[model samples]
Target: MPTESFDERFTGPTLNQDLWVDHYLPQWSEPARSRARYDFTTDGLRLRIDADQMPWRDADGSFRVSNLQTGTFSGAVGTTRGTHRHRLDGLLVETPQVTRRLWTPSSGELEVVVSASADPTCMLAIWLVGFEESGPEDSGELCVTELFGDRIGPLSSTVRVGIKAHHDPRLTDDVRDIELPIDATKPHAYGVRWSGDGVDFTVDGQVIMSSPQQLAYEQQLMIDLFEFPATEQREPRNYPKTAMVHSVAGTSAS
Candidate 1:
C-alpha cells in the first residue's frame, strides 16, 4: 500500500480575491479547504472555490449556482504536462471564469450545468479514470481508454462527450469501462446518480447512459473547463479532452 500524508495547516489563495478558497474542502481528509495554492497528494488534489463570486443558489431553487473561474489541477496532472510517474485516484472539477462557484452535494444527485457563451469553443467535461500502469515498449503508463474510449461530440452545436473501457494490454485480467457525457456549444446540464447497483448518467435533465462498474462511492467529484488557447486544428472546431475523475456520488433515479 502507498503511504499518504496531508498538511492540515496548509492554506492558500485563489487566483483572484473575489474567488477565495473554501477552507472546508470536503474532498481531502486533512487538507480539505485550500486558498489559491494547489498541489497533488495521492488520492486527492487541492483547489480554491469562491462562494461569493459565484452564482447564487438557495434551497428554494430561486438562483442558479455556477463555478466560474474557479480552477484546480485535479488528479495527477496540472494544466502543464509533466512526467507521468504517479498513479493518482479520484475526481477533479474546475472552471475558467471567476464568477461562478462549484457546488458539491452531500447526499443527493450530482449535476453539472454548462451555460453556452459566444465562444462556442468552451468545452466542459466530467470524466472518470480507474487506474494507470507502466506503459509498454517506449510508451509510459498504459491508459485503458485507448482501446474502448469513444467520443460523442457536440450535440446540435452544443456539446459532445464520450466513454471508454480499458483493457490492460499487458494484463488481460484487468478490464473496466466508463461512460461520460458532455456539452460544448449549447447550454446544457449533465448529472449522475450513484448507489449500490451502478451509476446513471443524465444530460439536460434526461438520463442517457448507465454503468454497473463505478467508483462513485470511494472517490471525490471533479469539474473542470478547458481554457487554453485553441490549436490550429481546434480553431474552428472544439476538440474535447478526456479526464479521469476518481470518485462519484449520489443515487440513481431508477
Candidate 2:
C-alpha cells in the first residue's frame, strides 16, 4: 500500500499558501481575472463563482470559474506555453508562471469529501493533471469527479470520470459519465487509486470504474467551481454558486 502523505481538513482562518494557488490558470488569463473566489470555513473550503466575476478569458464564451490548485507552471509571457491549452489556436501567456509543485504524486491513492450546489447553471470538479514542466506532451488529465448540476437528481447523479489525453501521445481520452445512486449536492467521498498498470475510481469506497492504461507522470490537483451564463434556451440562476470541499487525503508509493 502507498504511504500516507498528507491529509487536509482545511481547518483554518486562511488558505495555506504552501499547498494551494488560488487561481485557475493565471498564465493563460490575467491573474486578476483568473483569481479564485473562495474562503476557508470551519466546514472546509468553499469555492464560489459569483455573478459579477468575468469570464476566465474573454475569447471563451460565457463561462466563469473559481479554482484552486496544488501547482502551476508555464513558459515566459507572449509564448503559447501552458497547461490545458484548450484552444485549438493556442493561448499566449499573459503572465509568466514559475514552476511550483506542492503535492504532485506519481503513483498514489487520493480522496476527497466534497459537495456542490444543485443549481443547474453550475458545476464542480476535482481533477489531477500533469504539470508539464518537463515537456508539453506531458499534459494529460485524470478527472476524479466532475458533476454538472443539471445532471444531479434527488436520488442520484451522473458523474464524469476518466482520463483526458491533451498533448500526451501516450494517452487516449477515455472519459465517461456514470449514474450513481447518491445525491451529488450532499457531501460524498470520491477517490482514485492508481499505479503504472491501471487506475481505479471509487465513490464511497466502492469502485465504479477502472482503466487499464495509466499515466505515469506526476500530477497536481485542481479543484474548481464553474458557472455557465444563461443562453437563449437556458434561464439564468442566482449568483454565488458554490462547491464545498470537506477534506482531502492522499497516499503515495514514492
What lDDT tens digits, residue by residue, belong to model 2 across residues 1-254? 21237798989788888888999988899877899998888789999887678888988877889998887888998888876776657578988998887887888999999997788888899898887777788888889999999999889999899999988998989999999989998999999999987999999989999999878887888888988867623323665678899998988765
Cα lDDT, model 1, residue 80: 15
Lowest lDDT 10-mer window, candidate 2? 231-240
lDDT of 1 by residue, 1-254 (tens): 11121112212222222322332221221231222223333323222222222112122122211122221223332221111112234322222212122222121355544333333222334543221222211112111111111222443332233223333232222223333444333335556555556555666567655555433212223343332233322332332222222222233222
Tell me the whole-model lDDT of each prediction, alpha carbons only: 0.30, 0.85
Q: Which prediction has the highest TM-score against the true structure?
A: 2
- Candidate 2 scores a C-alpha RMSD against the true structure in Å of 2.8
**Candidate 2: misplaced stretches above 4 Å?**
1-4, 232-237
Measured by TM-score, how close is model 1 to the native structure? 0.35
lDDT of 1 at 98: 23
RMSD of each: 15.1, 2.8
TM-score per candidate, chains pooled: 0.35, 0.93
